[model samples]
Target: MAGNVQGESQFDVIVVGSGAGAMTSALVAADNGLSVLVVEKSDKYGGTSSISGGGIWIPNNHHFAAKGGKDSYDKALQYLKAATGGVVPETRLRAYLDNAPKMIRHLEAKSRVRYAVAEKYPDYYQHLAGSLPGGRTLDPELFDTSVLGDELPHLRQGAPSNLLMGRIAWTARQAHKAMSREFGWRFMVLGLMLRFKLDFKWRRKSKFDRRAALGTALIASLRRSLQDRKVPLWLKTEFRELVVDGGRVCGVRVVREGREVEIRARRGVIFGSGGFEQNQTLRERYLPQPTQAGWSATPPGNNMGAALEAGIAAGAATALLDKAWWAPTIRVPKEEKPRGVFAERAFPGAIVVNGRGKRFVNEAAPYLEFVEAMYKDQQASGAKSIPAWVVFDASFRFNYAMGPLMPAQIMPDSRLRKEWLGTVYWKAPTLAELAAQIGVDPLGLEETARKMNEYARTGVDSEFMRGGNVFDRYYGDTNVKPNPCLAPVQKGPFYAMRLDAGDIGTKGGLLTNEHAQVVREDGLPIPGLYAVGNCSAAVMGLGYPGAGATLGPAMTFGYVAANHIAAAA
Candidate 1:
C-alpha cells in the first residue's frame, strides 16, 4: 500500500541525487536553517563519488600553504593555464581555483567530515609549467558507517579499488612481496591481528579505509550531518518533472511508493543527480567509441541522466558535450572486468600493442594520454575503432599486478565463459600462435615481441617514453633492475586482452555561472535551480587535471551553490 501523508509536502530546498554535490548541498542548506529534502532515485545513496578514489584536488589549499607548501591564487591560475592549453575559459578555471580552499574548510569545519592532505600524490600535469609536485589533494578521514546502523545497507559500497573499506592499498611491489613470502607474511599478519585484538587499540574512528574505500565515508559523513539536523532523505523516490508555476520552478514531481507527489521548493531546486555515463545512446552520439563500458564498476542506478536531461529540458545550456573523462582499460575476459592498467607500462618488460601487433605509445604515460594515443591509432591505420588488444608475455602476468581484478565474479563462474562477455585472454606457447587465436596478424605480433625483447635487453624504450614520470614509477616495482618499464615479455605462454576506451563518468552537462546557478540559453539564471557536480559541466572544461579533480570542484561548487541560494533567499 502507498504510504499516506496528511499535510502538503514542502521544503525550503529540494536536492535530487545523493552524490557528493547533492549531499554537500543538502547538509549545507539544512545547517543554514532552511528545511531541506534530499531525493535519491535508487534504493541506495552515495552515487559514483562514493565508489571512487576519494581524493579531492584543491590546489594551493590553505592547509598545504600554511604547512610551507608553495601556492597562491596566482600560482594556481598559472598551473591551470599551463595544464588546460586554452580549451576552457580562464574565468571558470579562476573561479574553481580561488574558491577551493575556502570550500574545503567550510565543509570540514561545519559538518561532521574531516579531511587530511594527500601529500604524496602528484598532479597529472606535474611536468607542465606551474604545476605543483605533490600534496594539493585531500580526502576525508575514515568515518564509521556503523553509526548509521539501519542506514548502513542503503549506503552503497564503492568499487573494490577504493582502499578505505578494509582493503589495504599496496603498490605492485608490495603485493608481489607479500605473495612471494606467503608463510612469513601470514604469520606477520596474524601477529598484527592479534595485536589489534589485544594490546594495540585506538579510538574507533571507524575502520581505517584508504582512499579507495572513501566513497561510503564521504556519504556517511554527509548523511550523519543531515540526519542530526533532521533533514528528510527520501530514497527510492525519483524526480519526475519540474513543477513550474508562472515560469519559475516552484516544486518537483516525485514518485514515492507508486504515487505521484508534488514537493514544493520554496528556496531552490538543486540538481546533483550525476551524469549520463550509462546512457549508451548518449555515449554513441558523444563519445563515439566502444570500449568495455565497465558498467560493473559503475553504481547500478546511474542509468538516468535525470539532472542533465531535466536541466536541458528547462533550456539550460551545456558544454564539453563532445568529450568525456576517459581512461585506458584492459577488459580481462578471464575475470570479466575492465582493469585500469596504470601499472602496465610500469610493470617489468610489458609493452602494449595494437591489432596490427606494433607498439603504439609509451605504455607508462598517463592514462589520458594513453587513451588519446589509442584514439589517434584508430584514426591512423583504419583499425577497429571500438576494441584493441593489450598483449603482454607470461612474465608480466606472473610477476606484476596488471590492473584491478575483482576476486569474485559479478556473474557466476558458469556465465563468465560465454563468448559475448568479451573479456577472455588467449594464452599460447608462441606469440604467433597467440595472435592467430586472438584473430591478429601473427607476423606483426612476432615483430612487436622481437622489438620489445631487444628494448628489454638494452634498457631503452626509444619508441615511447614509458616510466618517464614519477607517477608511473610509483605504480611500478622498484625491484626491477635498470629500467622497470623495459622488461621484455619473453616468457610464454603469451596473453592478450581486449581493451576499450572506458571512462569514470561523462563531464558534459548543464552550464552554470561561477556561483553554480544554472545558466539558460539566453544567458540568464534559471530561477530557483542550481546544479553542481557531474550534473553540470565541470569547471575545468574537458580536461581532468589529476586524481580527485572531479570531486574537489563538485564539493566546492556544491558549497557555493547552497550559500548562493541561502543568501538569495
Candidate 2:
C-alpha cells in the first residue's frame, strides 16, 4: 500500500520523522544524488518544528564573518565544555561546532530555507566561559506558503504564543520586539495585520496567514525545496520496526494505508521521530518525578519515541535519559497543549514562588534551570514547587503579558472569559487576598513582596542574583533602571498564574557519535543506522546553552549524518 516514490521499494536514504532535522537530512541526501523518502507517522508534516520558535543556535556563524566580528573556536569550545560539564564526547561537541554553520550556509545556498541572525538574543549561560551576547541564534525568514501549493493545507499551524492573534506570523526578532512593546513595534504589528486583512483571497483559503514565519516558515521553506526535488513524504504512515538483515539496518517496516510495507534504504535509516516526552510510561520511567505529559509543550502523542525503542532493539546505546529540554508553561482552556511562558518570566515586576509563597529561584533564570530549581526545591525542602505560581501585581499586569493573558492595554481583565478567571488565572486586590485565592501562605506572600520591593529599590536580588546576567537582562525592560529585571509588586490588584515544569522535548534516546552514526554501548558504530533530533541524546547533554539549542544540534547532526552517508557510499 506504500507507494514508493519513482515506484520502487528502495531509497538511497530514508528519513523518519518530518521535522526540521529529518527534512534537512533528506534534502541534503537528495542533493548528494541519493534517492530519499521522508516518512511522517502523523497525518501532517513538520512535526513540532512547525509550532516552534524556529531559532537555530549555531555559534561562530556566517553573520559574524560578514560583520567582521570574530567568534573564536577555542571560546565556543570553552563555553560548551563549561556549559555541558564535559560529560559529552569532545569530538561530538567539535562536530556540532564545525558543521552547524556549514549546514546553515548550505541550506541558504541550495534550499528554499533562508536565515538571518537575531542580534539581541543572548546565550542562556552568559557567565559561562564561551558564550556570545547575541548573533549566535539564526531566525528563519518569512516564507510565502503559496510555494508549497497543495501541501499548504496540511502544514502544522504556528503556536498561539508565537503568532499575532493566533493567525499572522512574525519572525522571532519581530515577535520579541512586539511582545516587549519596543520602539515602533506598534507600527510593525499594524502593518502585518493590515497585510493579512488585505489578503482577502488568502482569507478565503484559510484562516491562517499566508506569510509563514517561525517554525512554520522554516519547515515550509524546507518542504518547498523537498517538493522541488520530488521527494516522497508519506503521511498516515506508522513506522512499525527497523528491518535488520545481517545485523545492519537495511530498511524499515511501516504500516501505510492499513497495509505493512517494507522499504529498503540502501544508504541508511536516520531516526528523527523525536523523543518520548509524550509517553506517560516513558516519562515516569526516565524523566524526573512529578512529571506530567500534559505539561509538555511538545505536540502530544507525536514524539512517543518509536525510533528510540526501535534503535534500542537494534542495539543502540543511550544517555541523558533523565534529562529534557525543560521549560515553564501554562495550560489554557480548550487548547490541546500548554502555552510556553518563556520570555514573560524575565520581564520586570514579577516573581516565581512555591506554595510556601516564597521566591525559591531567580525568576529570570533560563527556563531549564528555572524548572530544575523548582524540582530541587521540592525535593530538598519538601516545597510544593511542581505547580509553582508566578505572582505579580497590577503594575506587571498593565505592562506585561502573563501566559494566555496579554497586557492590560490589549487584553484587560474584563475581556477574560468567565471560565478562565479562577482556573487559567487568579486575581485579588491585596497581597493577602491574592495569596488566599491561590492557596499560598498569606504572611509569606506579604513578606516576599516586601523583600522584592526593597530589592527593587536597591537594584539587587540579594537572594537569587536576578538581573545579574546578560541573558536575564536581555529579556528585561531597558526603561526599568538600576536592574532591568527587578521591580516592585506593590500595586493593588495582584495577579497569579500557575506554571508547570514543562518541556519542549525530551533530551535522551538513541546514542550517537560525531558522525551521527548510532553507536552501541561498547562504542562500536552500527552500520546503516543513524539518528538525530530529540530521538538521539541531545548533544549538549543536560546543559541548555542558548535559544534554539534543541533544533541547532538536531539539524547540524542531520547534516553530518547526510554527509557521512554520502561519503560512505
Best by lDDT: 2
Q: Tens-digit lDDT track for model 2 on 1-569?
A: 23542223999899999999999999999999999999999888999888888889999899766877668888899999889867899999999999999999999999999988888899899887778888788899999999788888789877877888878888888877876667898899999999999999989988988899899999999999999999999998898888788989999888888777899999899998899989999999998999999999988769988998999899999999999989999999899899888888888899888889999999999989999998999999887998999999998998888888888988888898999999998889898998999889999989999999999999999999999988888878877879888899999899999999999899888899999999999999999999999999888977999888988998999999999999999
lDDT value for model 2: 0.90
**What are the runs in model 2 whose C-alpha is more than 4 Å off?**
1-8
TM-score of 1: 0.86
Model 1 lDDT per residue over 49-87, tens place: 776666688987767767788766777788777666676
Scored by CA lDDT, what does every candidate get?
0.70, 0.90
**Roughly what TM-score does model 2 have, to 2 decimal places?**
0.97
The lowest-lDDT stretch of 10 consecutive residues in candidate 2 is 1-10
Colliding pairs, model 2:
none
